[model samples]
Target: MANPIKIIGASLSQNVRKPLAVAHHLGLDVESVMAAPGDDTIKAANPSGRIPAMDDNGFHLSESVAIMIYLAGKAGNALYPEDVQTRALVNQWLFWDVAHWTPAYQPIQFERAIKPMLDMGDPDETVVAAALAKFEREATLLNAALDGKDWLGGGEPTLADFAAGAGLTYAAPMELPLDDYPNIKAWNGRVMGLEGFKKTAQGQ
Candidate 1:
């Protein structure tokens, strides 16, 4: 049997949870190490000092989205898919999460959650309001995308679900108002119901 892949990052992190959920869903053996971004452990594997780096049998890799795709591909899972068109669709949501969804939601998360937790003073309501505005715009797009579909890529949950869903890991804590986006709320429930997500949630 192959050695367990080392997944380096705190389990609670949304980025870390991305690959961890993929690993679990793909039935890949993985060992989670709790390290935060900028830590020396993470620095060795990712020059950018990012969390959620990977050491698969000594092959180091960075970036959460890349790690999730690699794990799914390595396991020959349907989550990553093989068809070009299907893969392209999945990639679209993955990239969207990194480029759009995350950017919109992260500021709200940092301000409402991370700031207070780290004794960084109270949240700047101005920052929160601006982020919420951006998040609402993005959520409208996502809600529309999920209007008739259960999953982003197709019928079965794919990397798209995992990648995009991670952005809402702190939705409640951050007080994200999801009531306005019923489609997203329903889809989120489905995504959270997956065994991989359930397993990862236990650690968090």
Candidate 2:
């Protein structure tokens, strides 16, 4: 029998959960190994020393987005899609999430959550305020995009949803100012309701 795919990283990490949710959604056999960035295991899989790397048999891969595409392709699932145009749409949101959304929100996460948890020190309110401002700008675009859509890509959930939604895993804990974005709040509810997301949330 073939070995299950190994995902190296902590489950609490949003990047780690991205592929885990997709794998669970596709019913793929996978194992999660908890490790943080800069660990030897992480370095072996990712030269940049990042968490959430992948080892399929002896094939090593890095980057959450790349790993997600690989898993979706391996499963022959529609999450990543085979249609060129549809896949492009998914790619669009995936790139946007990484470039725009993540940059804006991650600072808030690091300040409000990671710092406090790691005893790094009090959050820099100035930094938090700046990030929140940037977040509102990017979120306006996201909110508008989600106005009539349940998912980011199309009617059904796709890698776009998984990627974008994973970033919000700590929304409540981080106290993100999401109350104003009714559209985003509603869409998030749908994303959170997926079986794969639910299982990943429980660290299954």
In order of appearance, the predictions have TM-scores of: 0.95, 0.96
What local lDDT does model 1 show for residue 61?
A: 99
- lDDT value, residue 41 of candidate 1: 90
Clashing pairs in 1: none
How big is the RMSD of model 2? 1.2
lDDT for each residue of candidate 1 in 67-99, tens digit (9 for 90 to 100): 998898785678988999999999999999999
lDDT (0-100) at residue 85 of candidate 2? 96
The reply for model 2, stretches above 4 Å from the true place, is none
Clash number for each model:
0, 0
Per residue, candidate 2 scores C-alpha lDDT tens digits across 92-130 of 999998899899999999999888878999999899999
Q: What lDDT is obtained when candidate 2 is compared to the true structure?
A: 0.90
Question: Which TM-score value belongs to model 2?
Answer: 0.96
Number of the top candidate by TM-score? 2
